[model samples]
Target: MTAIELTGVTKRFGDVVALRDLDLAVEDGEVFGFLGPNGAGKSTTINLLLDFARPTEGRAEVLGMDAQRRSQEVRRRTGVLPEGFRTYDRLTGRQHVEFAIDSKEANNDPMDVLERVGIAEAADRKVGGYSKGMTQRLALGMAITGEPELLILDEPSTGLDPNGAREMRELVREERDRGATIFFSSHILEQVEAVCDRIGILRGGELVAEDSVSGLREAAGTAQTLEVTVSRADEELVASVRTVEGVSNVTASGDRLSVACDPDAKTRVLERIESEGVTVEDFSTEEASLEELFVSYTTDEQAASEQRGRTSDGKNSEGEDDERTESESESEEVRA
Candidate 1:
């Protein structure tokens, strides 16, 4: 069953469009990541899902309930850790969790949730003295204290260290394993790559791409990083290597050549280097990661959006033309 659904959701503020016909769905017990550049309306969409703001058009649903009409009920069953949310400065970490329990009318043990979030040791310290990472942990603990069926985390790992980030990812997985759906929003590609089962990338208030990490990488045609250390440094040989098809952005530092190339083309590169009589000392290829793929898509999407805006003469282009054509055909009468 789908836990969250947005159908053609649109929002505007005066002359600026925040979201334009955004459509998305997240299945139950799945970790869905919402990725986007700044000003792409990622937060706006989250606010709509949480019913903090009503959409100008379209509809949003959470847990099979209309988001705007049933906001109170939705809040009762969902946990939210919004970006830049501030906790009570005088309240200790434990107090924050306890407050959440009270606010949610849940009978959860505050200490247990604190310990689970690795903030038990800091439970007694006032939130004003807590570091950024500690505060994030406290927020997560509060969000999870009620064990809600769905969790919405916005930039949840922003202040975490490497270890803390890893723990956060594990916590998200654990929550999903326990039958909770997670909608995680972040600009950090690595975090999304590590935890998300599926991803939706927003650009200029539009969902430009939606797929699994691997699927996005495949769609972007990202290349692997191939590093090779050779015994002899030959300028001609390096030039030849650069000419090899599917190789991109080749850099040679002394005898080591770092080549970004399609992973499938590595064998051909190896054979060409071997035929050139260069003694290869060491070689390895790391697969194209989700980070690279995200960069490619976000960058391309931004560029494309800009191009469209620059070229548009305030009229519908091919996309709008196709839509108009389809609508006309759909509305036409059919003869027997």
Candidate 2:
């Protein structure tokens, strides 16, 4: 079941078009990452879904309700943390959470939400005195308090430290496991890569790519980087290791052998090293991260757009020249 659906949704502000024929679908109980660079219509699409901004054309539906006509009903069933969010500065953490629960008319205990977010100790502290990371945690506490069926998080990890970010990702997963569909928007590729089941990449108000991290990696033709460390380095062993199936490139540096290969080829490479009398002290693998994937898609899309712009410019120039020649011929006839 789809929790959200957008078909040919278009939104504009005066002359600036925010979304153009945007089509998106988010599955139930799945963590879907909405990815894009700054000004890529990620927030606009979210606004349309929330009915914060009405679309100029097309349709949007959330939880089987028309997004525009039944916005309040949709809002009641979904939780949202908008991009660069700020909470009530004067309110204590507990106060903020309890307020949200009251607004939602939810029966859940506020203490449980605060504890799950690791803010139980600071629950009585004013949010104005909280650190950026603490404030982010508080926002998340409120967003998840009502146990809404769908969570819409925008840049949820922006102010979080590494540990805080990890905890936030865990919370998202926990909610997903409990049957909530998470539609999160972020440019922080690492967190999204770690938590999201699938991703949609939007560029210049258009969604150009949508797939799993592995699917995008395959599409990008990305190779895995493997590093194996041992007690000692052996030149002959490195060369021999390159003979492993699917090992595309290999090099030796100090006590480690670095190999670039298919993601699934690491086990074979390690097995071959062991068979050849090489002792492995440590082995690690790194695939193309979401950062790499985002950059690859954005670069390709930018290049394609520039090429189309040049082609259009050339066509317009040719048409102008033809128009000038026709005008000159008409003037000559008048002179005759």
Candidate 3:
């Protein structure tokens, strides 16, 4: 079942287009990570999904219902830890959870939710004095009040320490195990990579890449670096390894040959080394990290735009300088 679907959805704020021709589908019972740099329209897409804003074109559906038409029903079944959520300063943390429970008409012990978020000790304390991390925990506690089937968490680990972030990921896993579909968004690639089943990357108001974690790594053309340690680095052996199919590049160190190749070629390369009568002392393979893959995709467009800007400035620099000189002369004449 599709938990959330957006088809040809476009949102604009007067002259500024926030999202354009966006299409996405999140399946049931999977944790989907929405990732992008700031101002990439992640929030706008979420707003459309929650019916907080109407799309200028196309439609958004949450839990198989039109988001705008069934906004109330959607809220009832969805728990949101919204980005930049503000809590009542005077209210106690326990009161916040209780309020959510009451609003959802859910029978839940507020303390349990508080404990789950690791804020039980501070539950009865007034929120006015809570730290930012504690306040984030309080908001999370409220989000889980009714065991909602769908959870939309935007930057859920904000202000959390390492331990707290780990705990949050654990809770995400727990919720997913309980059959909840979680749509999580964050700029922190490590956290998202840790918890997400599939990830979608948005760039310039469009869905740029969507796939499983490994699938994305593959799409990014990330290769595995294989280092084969031999008793002696042989030039002939290295040349043979380079000729193997899927092997992109090869370099030799003192006693190690580092080969960059497709992951599937690792075995073939290793087999060929033994075939060449070289004794393999040790070998190690390092695959591309998610962080590297993320930067490659997200920064490419930005880098291109910057290059274009530089080219335009270079072309007009002489003209701009001449205009500046003419303006200064005109100003001096007026003064005279």
Candidate 4:
């Protein structure tokens, strides 16, 4: 079953487009991660799924129902830890959980939910006295009250310390094991990389990549750096290695040559080196990390924007300098 689907969805805030021609689907009984940098339309997509805002074009469906027309039904079957959720200052933690249960018409034990979230000891404390992490725990407890079929968490680890974050991830796994579809959203790649069954990366209001962690690593064209210590290294050997398909950035320093290429291309590079008559002594390969892969996919637009800004600034500075020179020339001519 499809837990959530967005087809050709576009959301415009006046002149600014938040999401554009976006298409995505999260299946039932899996943990899906929505990953992106800030202002990448992750929140806007969530809002559309919950009917907090309507899309300017296309459709959003949650649990096989139209998100806009059947929002109440969607909310009833879905548990959400919404971004920037707030608590009633005077209400106790237990009260918050009870409110959620009542709203869902669910027969959940408020104390049990508090215990599950590791906040049973503070169940009676007023929310105004709770620390940020404590409040986040209470909100999570509220979200899981009814054991909803689908869970949508937006930055669920926001205020958590390292240990608290680990605990939260464990709970996500538990929820998924209990036959609930989990949609986890975060800007932190490490957080979701561990728990997610599949991940979708959003950039410039579009879904740029979606796949398992290993699949994404491959699709991102992340390569391994192979460093070979040879009996001899020279310009000719380096040039030959560079000519091999998929091998790139080959550099020679003394008896060591460093070549950047995909894992599969490592053998081909070695063959080329041997063909060039350089005896290999030893070699080591360093694979690209997940963080590196994340940056590679998401930073292109940002880098381009920065480059454009620098070019514009340079042009404006040149123009100003030319104007000053022309003005000085005009003043000199008048004096003459």
Best by lDDT: 4
- Candidates sorted on TM-score, descending: 4, 3, 1, 2
Error of 2 at 274 (Å): 40
> Model 2: which ten-residue window has the lowest total lDDT?
308-317
Q: What local distance difference test score does each model get? A: 0.81, 0.80, 0.84, 0.85
Per-residue lDDT tens digits for candidate 2, residues 195-277, read: 99999998878898999877876764667778899765675566555445555566689988887778888887787678666
C-alpha displacement of 170 in model 4, angstroms? 0.9
| Model 3 CA deviation exceeding 4 Å by range | 221-287, 300-302, 305-336
> What tens digits encode model 1's per-residue C-alpha lDDT throughout 1-336?
889999999999889999999899999988999998877898999899888889999999999999999998998999998887887899888889988999999999999999988989988889999999999999999888788999999999979999999999999999998999999999988788889989999888988889987788776555787889988656556655644556554557899877667877787677667867788889988775666556655664333333333333323324344434443344342211
Pairs of colliding residues, candidate 3: none
lDDT winner, 1 or 2:
1
Best by TM-score: 4
CA lDDT for candidate 3: 0.84
Better of 1 and 3 by lDDT: 3
TM-score of each: 0.73, 0.71, 0.74, 0.75
Off by over 4 Å in 2: 222-290, 300-336
262 in model 2: Cα distance from truth in Å?
A: 15
Cα lDDT tens digits, model 4, 22-93, are 999999998999999999999999999999999999999999999999999999999999899788989999
> Candidate 1 overall Cα lDDT vs. reference?
0.81
